[model samples]
Target chain A: MIIPYLELAISFLRVSLSAYGGGIAAISLIRHEVVVIRGWLSVEEFIRVVTLAEMTPGPLIVNTATFIGFRLAGVPGSLVATTAVLSPALLLLTALMLAARRLESRGQFRVRIQDAVKPAVLALMLMAIISFGRNAVTNLSTALIAALALAVLLVSRRKVHPVLVVIAGGIAGLFLL
Target chain B: MFVVFFRTGLLTFGGGYSILPVLHYELVDSRRWLSEQNYTDIVSKATAIPGAVSVNTAFLCGRVLRGKKGSATAVLGMAIPSVTTMILIAAYLFEYVHHPGVQRFMKGAAAAVAAQITYGVWLYARSAVRSVWVVLATAPLFAGAFFLGLHPLLLVATALVVGGPFVYRKAKLKAATSSPESEYSELME
Candidate 1:
């Protein structure tokens, strides 16, 4: 049991470190690892975890970790998995902060790094959009709602808050879906 | 104040776009901590980082509002609700979310989320993809990832290695063009 718990922690650590475009991107990877590779969870179990993670709070990645941990090893496992997943990020953030002042002082290096990073980041976003979109948009009503939402967003120039859009969409979904 | 944002964070489903409107209302319209321009700037910066833009925005906003104490408060607020909820759900209804009705609703919500994501991509492209060169570069990059089944991280890594030199040269050119004389002139003005 302890060994299984340790494996779960390490597996979550790998997922955390590899997740590039944040939580949504991480979900696919987590699903693949836990459901497909490790056999720790089934596909249905994976989706349930994801749904719970989405409906809950904090980072989705952390929520997923907690859920997976609890599922495998109870309360203690949840704590271990969450800590393991966050540790890498905490350490990386600390290292970055320590070097931040020095890095900022070097304008050329800073600009170069930004230049390299920006496009890559954009690419990641594009990937996330495409992948998640395929999974999310399935039916006609949904497709239309998504189209309406997109139009509202584009035309409004982000004048509206995303929360309202989500609420409106939810309400629309309740009626339309 | 922190608790308010925390609750908002927990309530937010979907992603950054889903939460953006609420955040704008709370931070700008209601709280009046910063102007619209400031909020937009922070969002841009948050997008550049490798995390949830909402979480990053919360951290930045908190820090701006109250320094380290504010930052701590903000993160705690944002984290607590979701952490608690997920844990409870994990413990109890671990098997309950998969009902057909629930899945149907999630599917519907996901569609709305898809649109939101598209809007985000369009918005970011408008600001970031200025030149034909950028478009030319971005289009095929997206196509390769989407169609070729290429992993996104690998694509990002490849882009960094390949685009680094040209981007470096461009930065150097821009820096050279904006000389010390202009910098001093602007400073004096």
Candidate 2:
């Protein structure tokens, strides 16, 4: 039991380190690793974990890690996995924050960092959209709803929130699906 | 303060994009600690770093508002609620989640989540894709990941290799043309 818990902690650490651009981007990688690579859980189980992570609070990565860990090795495993997934990011964040403060005093350094990061962030977001879209929009109803949601998001001036958009989609899904 | 932000983090659903309007309202419109421009700028920075945007936002906001202590409080607050909730749900999901109504609700929620994610991608693109180069780079980069099934890290690394030099050169040229004197002074300072 202890060995499995340790293994779960190490696996989650790897997943967290490799996952970029946060929860949504990490979802696929976690799914691949836990379900496909490690066989700790099946794909359906992975999806269920994702659903739970989304529905619950906190960041999705940590929530997912905890869920997977608990399933594999109970409560203690959950604690270990969650800590392992989070510690590296937190440490790196502290370092980066310190560096950013130092660099902010220098205009050229700040500008250079901004210039390099902007388009790269954009590219990463685009990748997230495509990857997630392929998986989520498997039918005509979902596709149409997604398109309408995009249009509403881009063009609407009512300041209609994304949550409301999601709610609307949910309503549409209930009626249509 | 930690409890406040932590509750906010846990309640937020759909993902980063979904949380933005809320964060805007809470921090800028309501709390007034963060300005609109500042919030947007921080969002960009959070996107660049590899983690959940909400957590990153919490950390930055906490640090800016109240320093290291504030940062710790905010991070813990934001993380705890969700962690607790997921654990509780995981414990009982197998027995309780199989109801037909619940399943139906989940299906609807999943579709909505997809839409929310798409909306976020579009919004980010609006800010990030100001130039022709960004427009040109986005599609193929996405294709390389989605169609080719290349890992996202590799795509990021490739984009850095291929696009980094050009962007750096452009920024340098802009600085050179705009105000070389000020740039040099600032660098020296």
CA lDDT of A56 in candidate 1? 57
Q: Which whole-number lDDT from 0 to 100 does residue A52 have in model 2?
A: 67
lDDT of each: 0.67, 0.69
lDDT of 1 by residue, B1-189 (tens): 787678776767764544555676678766788776556545544544544556666766776678668866776676667667777987787667766666556666667677766665655565566577666666666778678867666766666688778777775676568878764553332
For candidate 2, the TM-score is 0.80
Q: Across residues A54-145, which tens digit of lDDT does each residue of candidate 2 receive?
A: 66556778788878877777778788888787776667778977786685566453344444556556666666666566766878887877
**DockQ of the candidate models in sequence:** 0.48, 0.48
lDDT of 2 by residue, B1-189 (tens): 776686567666645544555565567755688765466556666666666666776777787678899878877887787767777887875566666666555566566666666655554455556688766776776667657876656765676678778766776676667676877765553
What's the CA RMSD of model 1 in angstroms?
Answer: 4.1
